[model samples]
Target: MTTLRPERYSATAIALHWAIALLLLFQIGLGWALEDLPKGAAQFAGYQFHKSVGITILLLSLVRLAVRLFRPRPEPVKDGRAQMLLASAVHGLLYAVMIGGPITGWIIVSTAKVRLQTMLFGKIPWPDLPVGQGFHEPAEVLHGALGTIGIILIGLHVAGALYHHFKREDVIGRMLPGAMKSHGVIGIAALVAIALGIGALICGRLLSFAPANLVTPPIPLPSASSEGDIAAPMESTAPEEPTAVVSESAVSSATATPWKLEKGGRLAFTAEYNGEAIKGSFSRWDATIVFDPEDLPGSSISVTIDLASVESGDSQRDDMLRSDSFFAVGTHPTAQFVSSSIRAAGEGRYVAKGTLLLHGQRKPLTVRFSLNIDGSRATASGNATLQRLAFGVGEAEWSATDQLRDAVGVDFNLKAVKKAR
Candidate 1:
């Protein structure tokens, strides 16, 4: 059998050691820097990236520890009883802290009260932490403290390795990786890792779909007689003329009262995107709106958007929207409005908020519309923005250099004329 040398690490071990070293340093720096950002989209993005990287490192560390335990490592020529024991203790603690820190952090994140994206490569995965009480807050504090402990351990580990390599001038410095030194490969590898990281981030957005369970809009009327005690609507944009349409849920036994399409109803809609101007309102939709105010809580608003009937008079723009980018009529077939909640805003206006469920994702939207009461017909209109990229509605690529805005402003006018028995 071939004889073993004093204390030089093998190529694989050295590479792994260095990789973990760099990763730990990066994690500490990024985490500290990210904590300084205000709680918003910037902080949200940073937290997501930090959590992802931490989980990755923790998994890698576990695997590395297992490898170390099974395989034999080079014994240092000058290794003493005290030095060896110290190294073993330090490494064991390091592994424990790394694993525990991230798990605690994840627990903290899962319990966050804000709407932040908690996804894995764009898949809206459930949080791994327990959902209730005292455990979570304490876990957050522990997560923060343990992160520092990990950093200190890494610093100690690195310093000790270097001391052995330089001060002792031992076999520790002669690691196989140190022997075959190359600048190009390291640079290329770094570039590739960064590129893939960015790509994964971008592509993740497309894959993730987290639906908001909103208070759904007024259920359509099966018949006036089918009304149960109408649940107090969360909000309502329907007029207060003693008629509210019965909620005709597809799954429920209630059959919606058939409404005749009315022409000349006014339309309104709005759009808002991060870092872009709040663009809104182009009312060309004139259609009939009808619903009984007394039956309001049970009635769901339905809109039949006449694409060809659109008279913004901008043929080229309308055609582009109707084609693939905006409406994508060929597959989606038709565009419709569904309300989620109908809470009163003020005066005659109520905030009708809900999911657009566009492209495929249920996009959260809110429209402030007026409820005009005139006989059997009720007119309602409002505005909301659609962030295109957030929902994978378009490529967002304009030209070679110019990038289009992530949001598209949509305006719609809706009139509901009360249908007969």
Candidate 2:
């Protein structure tokens, strides 16, 4: 009589099985963490990461299903018809939840009112499905329902595996690698840990918690004088205009006279969060211009912006913006721009090619503006688009371009008075 060999699953099938299992666990934990986070950069990042991992799971599950359809699987263990039917039903349900959960999440993202993109691992751009915003709430409800179903199905799957292993059946061993031995105690213990983790997550004990109140102390005012009287204000002096002789020369060599930013100047940027536009400004920034519209090559400009001075009207969101995951003000407190070249674009329009150093990264930037000079006073209005990711402004979880866009638009309206030579 010839000896018969026991069948085992292919390496690909086994690999996919374990990969999906681990990823699903991670996804579940991430989902819990995401829900626990308060609405800010941390929560925003958690949501993106959760979506990324869910998408990964979705892709892997599809591949696993495809592989199962095309490749051979281990023969079913010898068991009663009822037992076989139970096993098949359990597996079918597992696959359904695994695939359905991510699809529901995708639908939610696609239909969300806020236009958000999905980035795979914070690098590859993943587009949302072509779905209308009307479905967002419905899809969100479905996603939550699927998640609950997934937890139950996972529990049943683990119980079934334990039942087979404790009964000394060959089913569990068929999925294990040839080099590894299967023990009922070890498998049951692992399942118990997973069960406890799931229970803790459901009970809101892990990672999820309400945010504490954040207090921002008021800035201290200058102390009163020893006599208990406030200091007198300095006498104001009006800016002196260039003399007629100097003005005549400046008309020829405009680069010889420097320009001072006037009181009405404004610098602002627009950022998108959750499909809404957020407008902010750097309250403290200075610009030095040595320019002559007549001398393009000789003119130069330098701008220094205090990152900590950012104000977006919302205190919580402002604090989050200053956190390490976004601007990282503690490490890099200022951003700068220095002009390398200036060229006339049209009659009154000009383009300044420069290098912007932001968040410790330097990149070439161009600002286009139309300048109007009325003798001694000048005005410049311009806008530029900046890619936040290029400068590492949004770090780690904030790196997702879908939730927080990579492109930020900067606009400035500067009124400057020309200084005498």
lDDT of 1 by residue, 1-421 (tens): 8666535566666667656655655666667766665432233345556777777777777777776776667764467788878777887888777677777777776565432334543243435566665677898888778757876776576556555655544433444445433444434443454455334434533322121111122224232211111112222233222223333353144233334445554443333334544432222222222233344444344333433223233434444444445544334423444543345555655554443444444445555566665655555444445556654554444321134565455544444555664
Who wins the TM-score comparison?
Answer: 2
Error of 1 at 233 (Å): 16
TM-scores for all candidates? 0.44, 0.52
Question: Which lDDT tens digits does candidate 2 get at residues 352-386?
Answer: 65567677776766666677888887877766677
For model 1 the local lDDT of residue 402 reads: 30
Candidate 2 wrong stretches, greater than 4 Å: 1-6, 78-83, 181-421
Error of 1 at 214 (Å): 26
